[model samples]
Target: MLTPREFYVVIERDEDGYYVGEVPQLKGCYSQGDTIDELLTNIKEVIELCLEEQEESNKNLSEFVGIQKVSI
Candidate 1:
């Protein structure tokens, strides 16, 4: 059996009130849904599709340090 890989997901509520989820590690991996649960489900499917299209050369994902806010 293949070991499950863990990925970090970032979710936010957009201006239209939809929940948007993104996998920062996977470029262009994003999805949206009306609720958190739905967003999670949608993102999972998107991640799977992205993984399927991922090439061996693109498997080296960058390390996620952290997110910060800056005020002027």
Candidate 2:
């Protein structure tokens, strides 16, 4: 069995008030929900789908680095 992988998600609330979540490690992986709980659930499903698709291509998942905030 494969070990569980932990992914870092960047979340934001759009102008419409929906919570949008994106996985930086997985390219083109994102999902939105009405609430945080829903968003997380949806993101999990999306990640699974992305992984299956990646299996064929054998793409490498990027390592997660810490996020930083900068002000000009």
Candidate 3:
């Protein structure tokens, strides 16, 4: 059976003034653009790749319990 997975993204502006988007779940899945629209488009691909990676990784990790703690 197929399972669902989730991932996180972290976007920021760099010192050089470019918008940087990163997929934390998938290492090296990142992109930068001069504008928000471009960044979003680029990041969409980045996110998809991240999701694919998460699915691959889940093959080994899915058996373990998943938990998260956050403070807001």
List the candidates' TM-scores in order: 0.85, 0.94, 0.54
Off by over 4 Å in 3: 1-9, 23-29, 59-72
- Indicate the TM-score of model 3: 0.54
Better of 1 and 2 by lDDT: 2
Model 1: lDDT of residue 41? 93
Please list the C-alpha lDDT of all candidates, in the order they appear: 0.87, 0.96, 0.70
Output candidate 1 Cα RMSD: 1.6
Per-structure clash totals for the candidates: 0, 0, 0
Best by TM-score: 2
lDDT of 3 by residue, 5-27 (tens): 55545668999999997665465
Predicted candidate 1 versus true structure: per-residue lDDT over 19-60, tens digit per residue: 998899888999999999999999999988888878645676
TM-score-sorted candidate list, best first: 2, 1, 3
Which candidate gets the maximum lDDT versus the true structure?
2
List candidate 1 segments past 4 Å from native: 56-58
Clashing residue pairs in candidate 2 are none
Task: Flag regions of model 2 displaced more than 4 Å.
Answer: none
